[model samples]
Target: MLEPIGQATAAAQNIWGDATQWGVGTGVGTVSGGFEFPSVEEIDAVLSSWRARQASIAQRGNTLELMVSSLTQQPAEDDATTGYIATWAQSLTQLRDQHRSMLEYIEDYIKKLEAAKQAKQAGEAENEAAVQKTAGDLAQ
Candidate 1:
């Protein structure tokens, strides 16, 4: 009977590797350096930072939404000052909606990065196992 070897495919996107320092920026678990493939740790760190930022931005969006909700209840008087405040509220609403959309993008990208890492790590392990099995079978 052939025994199944372990696979590390789940660790494919672990880009941070053994590096002591990570670069500054939002990395989506992909090799942004082009010249060098990032370690899983590096990618994970970036994702974590991005998620934290997203949460913060989401809270800001909620606050903006609340401001819009409250300000919209007031009647826009004919005076320029009142109209300007109303316009500001409307702009805040637009900004909040945009932030929501941006959050979706960040979430989707993070998922992709995780999957990629897994596939890569697993694939490599799978190949190595196959090679070892073949050699063992030949020796048997």
Candidate 2:
């Protein structure tokens, strides 16, 4: 059981890389002076990466749920064993909820990124049109 948990933890680490690599909690949505917005391509790349990992996150959540279900089948003839099983199930449930929350976060972030990309592209198009119009005006 612990081994499965360790494997799940490793999977999570693989998805996010490391603690500092998590941009979900910080360094997002806030732009300081001189901070450049990500290029459309960069935003696409991030969306692609997170979309790829979304399935794995869902799988981890499923695994945690399975683990919780398995705890119910464990032999708990003694009071201590029953308490331990209850505790283990509670921990697994918490982990599953965390995974679900992370998945939701990723989904929301991806949508926001997509919206930003669209806005950037639209702005670029407008600028290009303005440049063309000014060029025509100058020729006339």
Candidate No. with top TM-score: 2
lDDT of 1 by residue, 29-131 (tens): 4465322225656667776887898788778877777777777565656688687886887788788778888989988977866775675567668878999
After superposition on all C-alphas, the RMSD of every candidate to the true structure, in Å, is: 13.7, 9.5
lDDT of each: 0.68, 0.75
Q: RMSD, model 2, all Cα superposed? A: 9.5
Candidates in order, TM-scores: namely: 0.58, 0.70
By lDDT, the best candidate is 2
- Candidate 1 positional error at 1, Å: 54
Report model 2's TM-score to 2 decimal places.
0.70
Ten-residue region with minimum lDDT total, candidate 1? 1-10
